[model samples]
Target: MNERLNRLANLPLRENLQGLAPYGAPQIDVPIQLNVNENTHPLPAEVHRAIVEEVSAAAVGLNRYPDREFTELRERLAAYLGHGLAAENVWAANGSNEVLQQILQAFGGPGRSVMGFPPTYSMYPLLASGTDTTYIPGVRSADYGLSAHDAAEQVKAAAPNIVLLCSPNNPTGTALGLDVVEAVYEAGRASNTVVIVDEAYAEFAHTGTPSALSLLPGRERLIVSRTMSKAFALAGARIGYLAAAPEISDAIRLVRLPYHLSAVTQATGNAALKHIDTLLANVEAIKVQRDRIVSELTRLGFTPASSDSNFVFFGGVKNTKAIWEGLLEAGVIIRDVGIPGHLRVTAGTEAETTAFLVRLEELLTQGVNNSPS
Candidate 1:
């Protein structure tokens, strides 16, 4: 055998090797992109300038490693979350995905289980697998709402070590009511399991919904993870954080890589925080666009979920693949969820939304005319 092939064939690997398709966001260069749920707006000029200045200042310290503790950034994040927590209760990572993986590393392992609701963020199972933890899923109801009763039952039966809940859940864009989340938390508490509230889209929730952070003070096992990628429009900057009890945060820190966050990343996030008002102003605009998109989709005979995030999920227009292809061909990109007949579209700029709607109409009309009488 060739030397390279002989060396590669002897490498050790895990037994859990039923490979799954890799997860990826669409990279189609479309004029109207509503596929990945990214903030359509860019950082304001003032924020960009502040970030450049801050990173420039930090450049002198390049010879030194970043603050492994991330003390200042954690403090800022704690304050930004409005959770009455101090820096001791917070941790940062390259992104929310890394923060999540750290949590799994700290709390999950072989013989222990992690649980999530299906049709939610697709990354949950992968994270569980990466940590050698068993994953259990509870399916959402037809309306995309978690059945609190069913969820409680599942927790009692599965006795998972970690429970992952995503508010304003991705793809579907439906948020769990505070009451439902509280009920789930109570169940997790009784089971002595950790509950992670993934609030990546919490900023887009309706006015009345309470963030999981607000419920953290009394719940020792509850951990809330937030990302700067969504409402903050810092997807490229890669700053995400988790707020938990100090002990839990310490455990996560144990697994985090030193200098995982670059000085520029921290600087960019700090600048973004200083301009939270500007960032949220764009969120308000997206909320309005989300409402309009949902309404238009419904009027076009799609059963759209009542979305509280910057995206909308709809169904009942069969031939989802055909529609997706037609839209892509027309320079529009949207996500085709694995769930049959369902599609998720993000609320982009008003002009992009308009273009998507126009393309959607054309596809639907063509589909109708081609159908057998």
Candidate 2:
């Protein structure tokens, strides 16, 4: 083993954390990076200016702690959601991962368990483990689809205290229907399970697809988590939030640290919200590229899942590792999501997408295909 690992192994780390790898995607510098599902587009110049101006204003007040409640930020977010939701129904944190962690903190722990459908966000189980909660993973269909019957039946059987459903699931790019959401909720009613719908990729979902936020009227146990990372082109901002019952927000308050969100974060996020339209201007363009990647991959005889999100998950590789190395050699870096014979790639700029496609085609033509023995 390497010296770094050897040194770490000698430390007095907790047994549960011992030998557990940190959650991370490779961050190699490449000409075209489609590994992480980050927005390829940068913020519009106008939004950049607004953020700069707001943060500059906030800088003067750095001597004092920000409003612990983040009142104005929540108000703006509630208005943006527009489901008649007030600030009381919203909660913000470092990211949706933290938001989910706080959820597990408040509602999950020892003796209580949280569950999720697999090949979804890889973070769900990690978040549960971090909160000292037991994690139970449910199975999805061969095609990575989870129907209402499948969800309800599994939820009823497991009876976990918390259930996480990732819409437009990561590494699969398939969306969960509202029918599935309703079924899981109904099944958990007797047990009072908290159902969380992670919608980090919500904004990139295809038109006419409804958000889980629309289903939050009387479902007190339901929480819809969202992020500005994907569609708003603000991954660097590290702001994510959730909309649920006011009581749910109140519960999270018990776990969140005081002044967790800084004045600069509140100001920058508010500024971004004010220029939402401008920030979202590139979403359609990104969608067009995403669709192009899917169609082109299909035409190349690869089976790419129908993608509503800003990325594509394609399969049918006989040797994913070989293709990964080949792509890297060609300066195109994508993700190997630990799924056998499958990989995912975020939709990059038009030129970057073309580069990826061309490089992939060249590799295929050069006999990079390695069938499983």
Best by TM-score: 2
| Runs with alpha carbons beyond 4 Å of true place in candidate 1 | 1-11, 368-373
Taken over the whole model, the C-alpha lDDT of each candidate is 0.84, 0.91
Among all windows of 10 consecutive residues in model 2, the one with the lowest summed lDDT is: 364-373
| Model 2 accuracy (lDDT, Cα) | 0.91
* lDDT tens digits by residue: candidate 2, 1-373: 5899989999998665678777999999988889999998878999999999999999999999999999999999999889899999999999888999999999998889999989889888788778878899999888889999999999999999999999989978888899999999999998899999999998888999988998999999999999988998889999999999999998998999989999999998999999988988889998999999999998887889999899999987777888899999989999999988888999989998998999888877877765651
lDDT of 1 at 31: 76
Best by lDDT: 2
Clashes of each: 0, 0
Off by over 4 Å in 2: 10-12
- Tens-digit lDDT string for candidate 1 (1-373): 4676666556664655343445687697877778889998877888888889889988888898877777779888888887578989888898899999999998998888899998889999889888899999987787777877888778888889999998888878888876766777778776789989899998998888788788888788989899999898888888889888889987876787777888777777777787788777899889989999999998898899988889999988677778888889989899987788788999998988899999889877777423322
